[model samples]
Target: MQPRLNFYKASQEAYNAVKNLENYVQGCGLEPRHIHLIKLRASIINHCAYCIDMHVKESRHDGLSEQWINLMSAWEESPIYDDKERALLTWVDAVTRVADTHVPDSAYETLKAHFTEEDMVKITVAIGVINIWNRLCVGFRAMHPIDQPAKAA
Candidate 1:
């Protein structure tokens, strides 16, 4: 599908502001895998294909196994995730669907067990950042690159 608009080109200053947040998130002490997983899960809930594709590629580049990546949508039932990962995913769900979930206290309690207060703030910011990106990309109809492998010819 064709894109509705080039958001970055439309406003480079605003785009750079977003990029600055991304840079902060990159060094926020969370594992790269965790960051990507959060991004992927949030993107999935937001139905942002561009972000899903981007994070899947980033997850792979960070050496996460295909099995781990494939189980993202079914994370609640999957055994691959550790306690911390599970907690993060739960938080991602609660926050990403905040309108519906209101980020229930139960989810916060669970996340607290896995993350320090500072870490929790960082994680929440990361989630918020991704949701904003999802809204922009989905709203603007940003197209993800096609998945086909390159031709040998």
Candidate 2:
């Protein structure tokens, strides 16, 4: 589907502000893989194909195996994630679905056990940033690029 509007062109200032937050998230001391997981998990929840495509590529670039990436969507059922990743995924769910979850104390406490206060704040912001992008992309029907089929060798 074509995008309903070009957010960057519609309001450069607004888009730039979001970009600034994105930059901060990249350097916010969280591991790159964790950041990718946050973005991907939230995108999955929001059903934003654009973001799912982007973060999956980024996650792969950061050395996350396809199994790790795919299993994240079913993390609770999978035995692959470590304690810290489980905590991170829990918080991503809590914050991404805050309306339903109310950002539960159990999730927060779980995150706190794995991260410092600063790291927790950064992670929350990272989640918020992705949610923001998810809304914009979903609201606008931002279409992801189609991949060409692999050519025969």
TM-score of each: 0.94, 0.96
* Alpha-carbon local distance difference test for all models: 0.93, 0.94
lDDT of 1 by residue, 1-153 (tens): 789999999999988999899889989898788899889999999999999999999999989999999899999999999999999999999999998999999999999998899999999999989998999899999999888898899
lDDT of 2 by residue, 3-108 (tens): 8998888999999999999999998788988999899999999999999999999999889999999987899999889999999999999999999999999999
> Best by lDDT, which number?
2
Reference-based TM-score, model 1: 0.94
Record all residue pairs in model 2 with backbone atoms less than 3 Å apart, i.e. clashing.
none
Q: Could you give me the TM-score of model 2 versus the true structure? A: 0.96
Model 2 lDDT, residue 121, Cα: 90
- Backbone clash count for every predicted candidate, in the order shown: 0, 0
